[model samples]
Target: MTANPTATEPTLLSLPAPDEWPHWMGARGDAQLAEARRLVDDLKAQRPSEARQVLRVWNDAQTALSNAASIASLFSEVHPDRDVRERAENLMQDVQKLDTDLGLDTELFAVFADLDDTDLDADASRVLEHTLRDFRRSGVDRDEATRARLRELSEQAILLSQEFSKNIREDVRSIRVRPEQLAGMPQDWVEAHPVDEEGLVTVTTDYPDVIPFRTFAHDADARRELVTQFLTIAWPANDAVLQKLFAVRREHASLLGYATWADYDAEVKMIGAGQAIGEFIDRITALSGERAERDKAVLLERLQQDRPDATDIDGADATYYAELVRKEQHAVDAQRVRTYFPFEAVRQGLLDVTGRLFGLEWTPVSQEAAGTWHADVATYDVARDGERIGRIHLDLHPRDGKYKHAAQFDLVRGVRGVQLPEGVLVCNFNRGLMEHDEVVTLFHEFGHLVHHVVGGDQEWVRFSGVATEWDFVEAPSQMLEEWAWDADVLATFARNEAGETIPADLVAAMREADDFGKGYDARTQMFYAALSYDFHVHETPDLTERLRELMGRYSVFPYIAGTHMQCHFGHLDGYSSAYYTYMWSLVIAKDMFSAFDRNDLFDPEVARAYRDKVLAQGGRRDAADLVADFLGRPYTFDAYAAWLAE
Candidate 1:
């Protein structure tokens, strides 16, 4: 029963209170923080005979605290106001410390500690099991001295992560280029970038600018300069932060009796050990090296033919040369393809595909009073058979102080009778039409929004949302990327401003061209995953060697001298040792797609099974089980291997 229950539907709950941005965030955060504390106190004060009731209160408090922290932290990451960001950061610190305190609270742990695990249902049992696990992990079972030290380490680790992200967010580096340097770029993009007083155009490292300049700019020196600015983003400042952050993680993991941070994180993921992750990376290296080298030689041949002065290519030369090779050899120019897939069309295509497959509809609603942080933000009501399933927010453009990457933020996670699930998909793409790959990226991120909000709707916050083991979290979204390649789906959304649909022949041509550079892309990710893994295994991260070594082995091109990619590699901030998850999740994603392809690409039966079993289930069950249930078979790497072979 909601506070404002209607006769028609109880689940059609009231909108969020205070109901607007800025004010609502702080007020809601503070109020929820208070309520959560009250709830926790109530739980601790309860008698052991009232275990069920106490557990209920604990669950409520868990959700409340989560909501409070989310509101505060969202602003800290995406708010344009620095003052709001600073205050939100402090608020997050306070909330996190409170969380640590509660997790370590002996009385809090004792509330449901003695309950017979067999007495509860599967969901409740899992929730209780997780609750106690978190408590134990927080040093609830340790002595007072050890508990204090653990708290200190938790604070330090979190604060360091916050700082690391802050640096990247504040990194507003840009390169000014002459109009001559931007020849062959898309028209809409060229028009968007107005020249300054000196007649030079400013190109930020935003994907919209960097990707275009690298993919279209014929000038090697210009692309090289832009790549340099991009590679060194927030350097020296971020460099020192990353170094200390490594030591803190090592200490934090060591205190937990783990040899490395990789070990600690792996304890909860689908893959069991740090060694297993390494072996996975090594397996990919073995499978991909020959193909990646062949692709590199092709690019090297182009480089030598075009720029006789260059014996080999560098990181700067990779994108530009690859684009050149793509055009000359495959008759596929990414910029040319972008003309067909505008942002609106691509977005509509995603909506269309989801509507068909999931038996759903999306209606645009004014979220103005909802206090959208930006004018570009749009809210949509997601419905199935005219009953609202949930809401989704799309913040699809780049702006200052926004999270500088493409991701889905589960702003409000679904919990039966408490609150509705809402998510925002944030990405930095051209305000105009996107390249084929950019469309794929959008579909991928939105896939996350759906997975986060719809897939994980359990009553308990701890049991809800995309809590799947980290390595498997990307699978659903990765599966969505396959939709981008489907000719039927592409025809639906791949339209120009004139409303001419993309030709089927072109789609086939583009698909063929797509695989030409995929080997290099795989190798690049392997480099990143390997580098991230090494950062954790050592006492101190010799990022210099790791970058050089991995770049040599996994990169399709040679590295540039005096340039450090790690300084700007924000993966070090949060992903840390888990960068391998991209490839890991990709394998599962490909497997899931293969199952879908075996039926129809837009098969309603497949979509329903996926939603009920995989997406909607969230982390309620093991990811492997969810996948198996959907596929009607056990998991295998065969689909991924087959895709790579093609």
Candidate 2:
């Protein structure tokens, strides 16, 4: 995947620097906004050539600003400093303005619309086309007044999103539990975080701390308190943030001349329309609902078997009892699973899989040389055939100031001939809890990494690497998750540091448990997607009330009172009305995986075809076109539904 030296190296201005904090972020933002203004002025003066130069300058500046903002924002989420967060927010606002000034809908499209396809080289044409399509979707074609309003709303939405995430990051709730109450938890977890003077083991809402307590803590009251605290993140303040964000998004969409937020947002997505997505959701819900009901019945029965007098199962009992079900049905102990899949082995497994599938090599870089946000973070030089392709940083473990979620940040987007484009994949998975399933999480994030590193063939920087349809971008990463589950793939990485392979029976047990409670998992995801879409689509005064009403209808479990779940839902800001992308992308991912199943799971010929036809192409062609080309046929939902049966 490494580019030839003759290929353009990505501009240095576009790359993110590690040590430069708030000031670099501010300067980057100013540069981008200044470039955008230059472009506007050039166009107004009727200087076409100067206008084009200005556009290129703006693109480069925007890319750098965006990369810096993403890194700083992620850092502040974990670190929780007010200044860093505010700087990140300010930079984000500058980006939104560029999007508006350039015509969120039309400016991008205009770049491609007037291009003489043959005049520019292939790379330039691809970039131009990508930018054009992006503008079209962003409402660049809207009237001047509407476009102005859209820009304002866009800026407001960014501010609201940052506030929403900040509120959650700053929220720390404490609960007291006796030493005995933590009985079922692993001793390491309890010792790692102990409360002061109250005998309470304080656990934050961070996944590493929260998940284990939910899954293992023996005391019902203690579990209830933690679960409540986890769910109630961002609370009343976040609720207002979410409502404002939704309203801003809706207003932005309406100004762009769409009937609803969903309609406007779906225009550039794979589904193409709100109705199609709604239909897809309806079908999946029907199919999955039956399985979910049966799964819940068996689980509830098992719960009763354990605690005979327990009448109702609520939020706190969900994970604890689910663990019981997993052990009872599959004999797969989470702790035992962790013993085999150590952190280093999982990391090696991910690198190994990418090497095999994409003909790429990853050499670890020193922390001092890489200049990252934290000591634990590592950078890797991605190369192919002895040539540098791109670079990516893997911030794997949870840290104090790191974002408490797994996400891929596009630090420096690739433009053809641009050398050393950079990206970072930030995740908060437990290094200690190295369960077999955690391997899947690693592969999933690596999927995003592969997309960013491999697809630098686009002419325009904007269209480079996983910058396709918003809904379709997840497919490449989602497809990687399948490899993690395959035993053949696991054999390559699922070994001890001492080089002993994990037991076959143990692997089998984990696979069984992987399928266990999948129905419940699907339903839970559906609930979140439904809630996200409903929040954006509804045009009502009381956002909280509407959310409750929708939850009552869509959620299988009863909604807990006094908790504002939407407040902490980060995706609501950007993915509003489009959170269903997860499920939507799964359909395409499953279809793509079917190709490997047919040719050969590890077949180099098939892998090469994918690398050449899909990964190498970036967002130059329509996402569906790439999928169809790679699969040698149109994508269908059959394979996706069939996977659920397995």
Candidate 3:
């Protein structure tokens, strides 16, 4: 790929340089909004006889706005320059408001309302159906005052959500400890954090530092200190932010005839309503309870070795003690296992694994050619049978202002004969050696990237790239994590500096050790899921009390007083009332994985069938239909049940 570009070309594909972001964002954003509004006016004046013609214009306008919005949104999270990031954040709110305004346009809604959906293809019909539903949800039929109020609330919600995330992203808390406090930490990790002139190591709550610290460091007090700081991220700042957000959302939902935000949020998801969310949490909790207790007992037993009077394991000690059990009982030494996985190797291995499975190839694209925001970001062109299909960018390290967690963000939606899709994977992992869990996380996020690329080649932008129901979006990614656990899979890519592949027995032990934490993990997810659901369903929300009640009810660890876990829970803003999606998606993921032959991780027949049936379907079919198309039956909780029981 060439880096050179004609300076006069639009800056959308090749993102503007940091200094040019504000000007480019403002100019391009206005162009998109003005064009969309003009298109809506044109459509109102001259209704096309053919519905497809109307839809084509509708899709194009929406797509233009979406592309601009996606860029602004992504840059807000990953841009290193604060001024650029701030500009992006503000632009995103404006773009969101403009989009919401378009959705509420009565005249525009009527144009779609009158479209004859008969004799249309699946993708076109699906797009029409969703558009009509969305318009109603946007209050298109409401009175002028009501519509104006909805718009106001929508803008408020977007701004508040941004503030919530911004608070967490900017607030990087840390604790200092002596070298002795890092006794059980990986040597590489300890070396990476050199002692300052004060002779103390600084550990921040960034994922690269905090996760390993919690999982390995021996000093309980230090672990407690770090964990407490980690949990308190964006605390009091987010408290008010969350309060205003909930108020805005509550009013918005009420105006829309929804009883609560939870009800409104779940209407379009696989999970139907707030009540069902509670049932789901309860059902999963029951399934994992017995095993969770056994795990707690084992962890507490390990804890008592250090403190004879220790009664229970707290959040700070959970991962530390769990590692002790894994090494002693399952022969899975996490620190030893990490030696085989460096970030670069894991990165290439990930491409190789997915490429083999999907009959695709990935070729590196230079940063300049890709017009990336940072040097650390790497780009790849995806192809099948020599025909380029899509592209992906990987941003895999921690920085002061970067997003604190891993996720896949869509930069472009591949509309066949229009534009090819592009997705970005933003994560935080150690640059050299990586934890096994980090490897799995890498695989998981890439799964979303793969879905976006493979599923993207759709006739309409609406049906392109991981556009499935929100709750089902994580299944493909979660299922891909299974590959990371396979011994053969690990042997292919996980080699140490000495070039020794991980032993099959070691992978086996790792898998067994992995099973040990499932119950606790599942229960912890339940706690978050409960908190997510509880916060939205009620008329009045006491954020702290709700967080405390849910944590105590479902978590293996007791809630630390004065700590506001919800403040740091970024999903509360993104997923809103549906953080249960992770668990819900995992149930589907486990079920989907059962179709694979365990011995052949790269079975072409199974791989191709899945790629065509599931990934290629995108949002054209219902998620359940897509799952059934591959599995030859509706997905069930059986596989998930069996997994939890393991």
Candidate 4:
């Protein structure tokens, strides 16, 4: 793992310095674009006799450009300060335009096209081929006027995507809950939500805030109010923004000779087309749709156990009663289970388990060397057999104006023995001890970081990290969640403040109870997958109505009037045509987990096999080929189907 002189060389595998990432990168964004243009000009100025240096020159420029834009964009999304976010967003627009220009530059593509691939390795050759293909898809082959129009469309897309996501972050609404309404909620949760002078507790739409209130708060009126507000986030304003977004996308797709954005986007996906994605959903729905109805009836019966004359079930009421049924049937206390899984301990346990599985070790960077934007964030260096290989940053708390979900952002892409990749695992877990689901989430996001780091072994920047086909990218992450379910793995760190291990039976019960909502939960995910998938495939004027129709058809609970889940459906912002990627990815994830199922959950042999065949390959191979190599067979849906049935 010593640094390779031909790559970044000399100072490689040094601790990641994300703190070095400019806090307000507005100025840096402009400078980076200027350098990028200069580099591109240099490429054009090079002699025809200089074709030997084309790969090195172009690869270096692309790396610098990507690093700048990614740093700026990531800050724009997650920075705690609004001023920094605004500045970053403003510069990001220009970066996006320059990015488009640089990528679609006919002159640069010609240089790459002129180069002989005979000198390049297989991976570098594949990288160049993909670049050309992407450029063609971007309309590089179009007439001058059409190419110019495509550039305009590309800039508009960058702005609209920014605006659509901004609306989701900036839209503000909160509800006042009466003190009595906090009944049935965990005491810690109750205490966290303090009442103002008016004696009304307040809640916002953040997952930690609203989800707990809905799931455990006994106050029907409070849950109803919170649910309504949560559903309508980015409404009225973003509604039109989304329509415009999709319209532009549809037009963009048409320009590329595709019927819809779904088809246009699926040109490089595992499923191949939106129609195939739809058919997959139809197959699952046919098998599970009736089971969802039965699940709903069971929940309604539980609700009626209290309100004897209850006539209908609202989405808010479903959660309150579902918790009751879980306890009654499976003896699980979702909140009580949190006592065993503190944030710090869970982090340690995750590192330990993954380290043992993959034969790696993690060490925190010295505080002086740990460059961080927020004091809460920390950095760690990953090593294998004493050779530093990668760096990871942890930003695991929620605050006002922060990105509202859990995700891993690749701050730097590494090539083996070259530039060590740096990944930021940003999540919104409770600062307090987390619930088991949050623990699962911690593992899930960590899986992404591992992929970003382990998969960074590739030689080309474009092929580095989690660069697989979009839908299959989540499979490795989801596969890691199985470790969270293992009792032995949890025992490694599932201890309370008192230092007592979580009881084996308690862990067992929570695991069992977590499955109680599977029938309805699977249906809920399917409803979302279909709504997003069907819309992009067949664009229509009445998107809200289409959303309502899908919900009415697939949802376990009846659709509520005046509620608009699509408004908060941020997936539409970027994931529009590919929202089914989650379930689609899970099919492969479940199959991969089968390798470890027959052996020890932490079987090192299986773990190393997964690392070598899947995680380490990145985009070096097609995802199907990787899966086939790992499993020694073509992938199948049998494991996924059985999981759903279970």
Candidate 5:
């Protein structure tokens, strides 16, 4: 199982003490900011050299705060200390303010705009250019009043988003399941949960509790009720948060001189405009809809055969019935796959794959090196040719007060001379034995971890790994999913403690089952992308109404009553109109993977070229140019469309 970092052990958690290293770091940053202000006064007195010193001081202050904020943010969700959480949030805000005062935005733009063709500092030049672009997209170029208003809107939005997320984290619904209702569930799952006075098993709303209950529970009415409760998380307050956030975002975009929020968001993305995303979504929806109808018919036929008296299936039945279909058609069971893929084996397999593909080695670091998020979090040192390159911390699992999302948090970005080795990956996957599909999720997240550790070519921290165009950032990570599907790669790590191998036929059957409901899954994702874009692009006063209208046209399942999914869709503010990045990057990823398919899947030369040209370079070059150069041609959607056809 993918590890959930939030689970509790008997011992006390080893979180950072209030007076740890970051406290000094925070103080140092404040001092530097004060020094910069003093230097600015000196600059007004006509000392040009002193002005340069002030700029350096301001840069130093910004870097210190940035580092502290990154570490604190990751730790805050799981950190037991209230002080640490508040300190981290405060430092992040201070850094945001410093960014505004340094004139770093305009200064960096001027530095890049004046670069000579023959300049050897290409990495630094590219970093400056990227920073300038971010500043412009952030509305830093607006007049004083407009910029202040935009900043206020941003601050308000951040606070609201944080509060919304907190509510979801704390909102736990307890369910009681009798022994008869838990017939098909694994023994460990049934025992792990508590039993109430009535001898009914009580489970919380965590994915570990919710997913198994949805798939294995035999009581139809109980399953339906639980699913309804799960879907309606963070209801009334979160819905209000979404409404206010929508208005704030619209105003922020207007202040930046854009026609719609979508226009403002897509301006700095790789796609160049909002229209391109709309066209791409439309094209995929047409193909996905055809396949979805075919799959839905097959599912319905099976449902009738299994339950001759049942009339219709709804959202709650989807998972349970899908598992039944898999068992009937392919004789594949998710729980059986979990026995073969223990968490430790999957992690080792990923390390082995990276070692071969990128010529790197990993060594475990001391827990102290990880600096106290939780005792279970593991830190590792990444090296190539016996030389240390960088570090990555894996905080896997879920617990109370922890962030309930699966994402990679970049704690410290690596730059050539400016920053030390730094990075981290955060996730909330089950930590015990995992299903085969869960192993694929591991590979996908490891893709992000490797991206962070490989140290890109950019000279500044702002343009480092995973900091490029939002639409293009997913390409490297998505391409790694292909590795999980390969038998050769799977064989390297799919072993028991006694060195026994899993049967080859089981792996093949697992792959077949994995692709079984691709169409339905793809369509569901398309619905989210479409809904997110439509909500941002519309100028209407009611976002929920707009969301419902779009859902009616695009979503296969009927919208559930009394729930607004957008309230919990925290990514709406950040990714906003850029949700199509997932699909766009999938196209590029498929084309990139074709190289390995054409050559041998394990071709050393091909792997080496990919590592050098794409993964290692990061955002030093324009993303389009980098992709073209690596592929020896432009990216095309044929591969993506054809993959869906399969």
Candidate 6:
């Protein structure tokens, strides 16, 4: 690894107390931004012969800036204290402005252009190439006035994104229900929400409250009411925010000589173009067409058993019927499955599974060493061969004002010998027992955690961790989800309070039941992919209307009026027009998993090979090359297609 030349050792990242956040974050961020500017000035004055050294210095400075920004941004999403979260959000905007300014620095671009690419090693060459490309994409080559406008637009984009997410996070709508409305839900779930003085129970749109209610609640009106609230999250307010966001992005793309925001966004991804995303979405939809129809038929038929006069079902009814089908036909009750998976057990089991597969050890980190914003957060140090590799934090339960989804956020990028990688997995699940689907999510996010740790050993920070193509980032995590389904893997950790492992037959039933929803699930994802794509590709005035159109085209369920799903579609902010990346990456994941022997998922030799060939390469190689190296061939869609058909 190349030394930073400016520092002997980089400071490890940690969350400051809420009271100290504003000061610590403000001072650290200011210093890092100033240092980055100073390095750019140094690079501009350096002789061509010193290009390599000066570039390394520049990278070191930017790395520091990135770490500060990332840590603050992560806390902004997951911190329990609202004021602290807001402060962190403001800090994140400052970092985004600095990043935009750096990207648009023509002098820095000129300095890089003067360097000879042949002088650098393979990894460094890739870094230089990507940097130059990014500069061009950032409009560094434009006139001064245009560059200034780009800077303004970039900052606006950041603010708008923050607003969109904040609206969703803050809006937690609820409904009151009678005790009879809780029928069919688990006894524990029912007990958790005791009747109030009015002889009513309150259910909120939080995942823990809403998911089971939608799946198991017998009262159709109660389920539909809750679904309406869930789907309309951040409705009228985000309506305007989203429109402004779209306009700003459209103008940003227009200024950069692209037809649409989607076109501009797709340039850096593996898919290469917006039109190609449409094609991919169409292809997947076709692949799932037969299965989706069959599944929809079964669901519609099941609906008729209760409502014989009903001709169709809405999104609210889909989950209930699907669970009913799983219980009746496949003999797997989701509520019963939750009994085996206690939250704490699943956490340890995940650590054990990954550690055994990758030949690593994990030990708890003291609170003193790993400062946290919340007590619910847990910290660990990951080690391989008795050497500390990275630090990871798990913030894995629901709370008011927390991010409403599960994801892994990188707190620090690991550049070997310079700093240790740090990541936090933020999730919302019940604190006691977890739903089986929640277990899958945990494994999936942990896959990303493992990727960040294993891939952080690269010499250049730019190529470190999950810094690969934006489109390929989800593949490793998606691939890791397979472990959640394997009977042997489940037996290791899934247990009841009575100390009994989950029955193998029950797992088989769960597997069989899982097949029942494939068609509808695939179509649902296609709807999301299409919605994400069309919103950027087509400049429609009515996002709601366009969303409805896409829903009809891609989803099996008809659009439910009065639900503005786009308001709470958070990916429209972060992922922008690249939501198709999920499906694209899944294709690669399935193909790669084909290399593993299903009967022996714990094969050390195969696991080690995957670790070295895929995760360790990081962004040093193209994603295609990385996969080919591990599989001895390029990935194909056959695996995904077969899975969808099954």
* Runs with alpha carbons beyond 4 Å of true place in candidate 5: 1-62, 100-121, 309-312, 496-499, 539-545, 598-600
The full ranking of all candidates by lDDT, starting with the best, is 6, 3, 4, 1, 2, 5
Tens digits of per-residue lDDT, candidate 3, 1-646, equal 1111223321225666656767776777677667766777778888775788888888777777777788788889998988878877887887888889888889888888888879788778888999999999999999999999999999899889999999999999999999889898888888899999999999999998999999988888898999999989999999889888888988999999999999999999999887788999999999999999898999999889889998877888888889899999998898899999999999999999999999999999986677778888999999998988888999998888999999999888877766788999999988999999999999999999999999988877888889899999999999999999999988889999999999999999899889997898999999999888888877445788877777889998898766888898999999999999999999999999999999997999999999999998889988999999999999999999998887
Per-residue CA lDDT of model 4 for 348-392, tens digit only, reads 889999999888899997645865667778788998878777888
Model 3 stretches astray by more than 4 angstroms: 1-12, 17-19
lDDT of 5 by residue, 318-415 (tens): 77888877877988877766677778888878888878888988888777644546666788777788866677777777777777666677666665
lDDT of 2 by residue, 1-646 (tens): 1112333445423323554656665676566556555545544444344334534544554454455455555545543345656676666666666556565535444534664555555645555555666677677776777777777777787777777876776676656677778888875676777766866656667877777788878787788888888878778898777768778877877776777889888887888987676677667777687777677777678778878986656567877877877887889777666666778778877888889888999998876666665667778888888888888888888755556678887667776564356778888777654755567777888888888878865555666788778898888888888777777777787775566776767767777776767676777777778777777677667766776786665555666666667777778865888888998898899899888854257788888899888888777778899999998889999997887888
Off by over 4 Å in 4: 1-24, 47-52
lDDT of 3 at 151: 94
Report the poorest 10 consecutive residues by lDDT, candidate 1.
1-10
- Please report, in order, the local distance difference test score of every candidate based on alpha carbons: 0.78, 0.71, 0.88, 0.80, 0.68, 0.88
State the TM-score for model 5. 0.89
The residue-level lDDT of candidate 6 at 60 comes to 81
TM-score to native of every candidate shown: 0.95, 0.90, 0.97, 0.94, 0.89, 0.98
Q: How many clashes in each structure?
A: 4, 22, 0, 0, 17, 0
RMSD of each: 2.6, 3.9, 3.4, 2.9, 6.4, 1.7
Score residue 236 of candidate 4 by CA lDDT.
Answer: 81
Candidate no. 6 TM-score: 0.98
Q: Model 5, 558: alpha-carbon shift in Å?
A: 2.4
Cα lDDT of model 1 by residue, 363-445, tens digit: 88875445466678788878777877677878888888877888887677767666667777878876777888788898899
